[model samples]
Target: MKKEILNCEKARSICIVQTLAKLGHFPNRKSEKEAWFLSPLRSETQASFKVSLKLNRWYDHGAGIGGNVIDLVCLIKQCSIKEALHLLNDESIPFTTEAPVSYPDNSGIEILSVKKLQHPALLDYLKSRGIDYKIASRYCYEVNYTCKGKKYFAIGLQNRSGGYELRNKFYKNGSSPKDISLFKTNQTSLIICEGLFDLLSLLSYSPTLATIHDFLVLNSVAYIKRTTKLLTDYKAIYLYLDRDNAGRKATQYLLTQNPHCKDMSNLYEGFNDLNDWWLFQKQQSG
Candidate 1:
């Protein structure tokens, strides 16, 4: 019965934005990727909660929690996961899989090859970022692909959705299913980074730190809403976002939701980001 319920939840996973609308909670603002709504979880006048149309996930910024359709139902209905599934199964509530959501098309991007990160260009790129090739290899690869009829290659870091976030000296992009990359250590604490390079820089700075705490890399700040759901299980969340406006806002948003969230950006003060700070240190020391 549990297996059947889980399968049903996966198969009938509904678009959360539509669900919100059905609940009479329309978004105040929306875009191609996400929608912002006044959080239904609490009495918030400001629309801080958001729903990712492509990912079919919702994050309640006020509550610092998020999840899939089942999780959302569970929260709103104050029921168990099993009860949430039952509620979703009711005929009165409509859950359709036909809604069109704007997501990146990966069909144009063909991964021609993937191998060890031994390419000199990629190694040099890592060196330029002050990240060790050895550490990078553990989490990244040399990916050769063609997109829009042009051939390209880069260091690829795979996200939880099985898509690659590619980076190099000249290109920074990702394949379809853009999602977060979670490195779990079975620990209660987590270090959240805004980009893959920052995660790599931290690992390179202290290899032992990887063993003590987990890490989450959001390929883009646009996914910060989706991140709130993943962070609920952790007792501590350390933010290492960029020093830019978007990064600062995201950090403040998360800190508002999760009081335990600590700002680690101070460690790299005066630099644009963690990787930039690490590179500057390496250049000065060398």
Candidate 2:
């Protein structure tokens, strides 16, 4: 007896955008030929991911990586290439099975709606951050909610617990049930970062890094210990944390734990963090 897997060609023929929906995802924007989404593998405020309906290609602008359906599954599920093939080959199975959100946090935040990312205010906010709406809308939502007797809205990045990590130009807060964000590739290399901006900045420079490497985004340095347990499984780990005391302490602690860990803060030396360095580069280039 022999096991079977989806041939590369078969997997390539499947509709990329439809697969995204099947995996509890949908595009934020779409046109005749293409659809845009926030990269599903990691949390993002911009729609940096795209799927070509006509060509059946997918790309993530922030990460700068793209491919067909097989590549999409491999990246989203953080599974191996072989695993993606087998998963895609099975039509009877639900796409990328996810457990129900356990103990979600509403925290007095009343969610009004979650919809395709659109709205001038949110788009402008993303632009101010040097992110494109075309990219941010993919994995993020234009979320409207009420809290403290006031109505407000922002870009929402859903957590594993079904709560949202909310952000905007003036407002920033998590709805509840905050947790770490992980981009698992089951790869030998891991890229660790302190917050969302730092992770996005790194991905903008090297899109293939996530595909080739793995990611453990603390979302806060509080999750540093969570990463120590993960490091034992990787062949190499890169730390892209901030240049402050907490970040430094976390980096030092990880270094003592794993010989393969490398601190990449020097890449953004003289700056607050990776995003600041990236923003400065953009200014200089202009």
Candidate 3:
């Protein structure tokens, strides 16, 4: 079979509805139209999933999964360029499935120009995402790209390799390594969270912790190997994984491997992560 190139617009149109329907944005004229079912992806109880044929959308409250037609196709078919187009063309599925024509993959693409760190458009996106560009600038830079004669810029983290860890207003790319900050404070206290946001939230809320506590942000749980040895050194390491399944699993796995470490998830039991807990506190205060 010949390789299939996708028409971008068609694929996008086809995917938007499916994603919207899955996200429960679909309009339901009647109670029956709000049909509910168990999530098809993960095993769970309760019919949190709903479909809105009238609005041509779907939503699953339990999983927090929502998107448009193109996103749904990407999730369902594990889309490649050709597959995305093919799925869009199939009328058996709801909504139009057409996408702009995609060019061949140039995997070994090289950098053309590096963008300015303080570009107004770039800074605006960072502000919207709750990231301070001043802080982000310490670790990331910007780069420019051209597609079909259009110019765009992206912020990127420098990797060990010369290539950048690229992220833009729309997307993020590359991998972030697990980073652990160790301090031997007399208080014998330590904290751990999944990402920088959570750590910053914790620091912002707990002024008392500034005295003698060390912290770590396991960039990816997969990098746990780099952290296992460091856990042994801390007198009371706090496992502050997210409240989601991945977070719970990491905490559980760490306890199994290093029983001496303390689990800090109890500090924010109801919420998903440290940042979530902060948001909760912010809401409660208001």
Per-prediction TM-score: 0.63, 0.58, 0.49
Where model 2 places Cα greater than 4 Å from the true spot, the runs are 1-106, 133-139
Ranking by TM-score: 1, 2, 3
The most accurate candidate by lDDT is 1
Look at candidate 1 and tell me the lDDT of residue 201: 93
TM-score comparison, 1 vs 3, better candidate: 1
Scanning candidate 1 in windows of ten residues, the lowest lDDT window is 95-104
Error of 3 at 84 (Å): 9.6
**Total clashing residue pairs per candidate?**
0, 13, 38
lDDT of every predicted structure (CA atoms): 0.77, 0.73, 0.56
RMSD of 3: 11.8
Worst 10 residues of 2 by lDDT: 99-108
Query: lDDT by residue for model 1 over 1-286, one digit each (tens)?
Result: 3333445546347667766665567889999999999876555578988898888888775444567876776545444567666666554666333332222343345677899998888999998888988889988999987664557888999889887888887555566666888988699999999888999998888888887898898887778888878778899999999998878998998999887799999999998899889888888899
Better of 1 and 2 by lDDT: 1
Which residue pairs in candidate 1 collide?
none
Which residue window of length 10 is worst by lDDT in model 3? 100-109
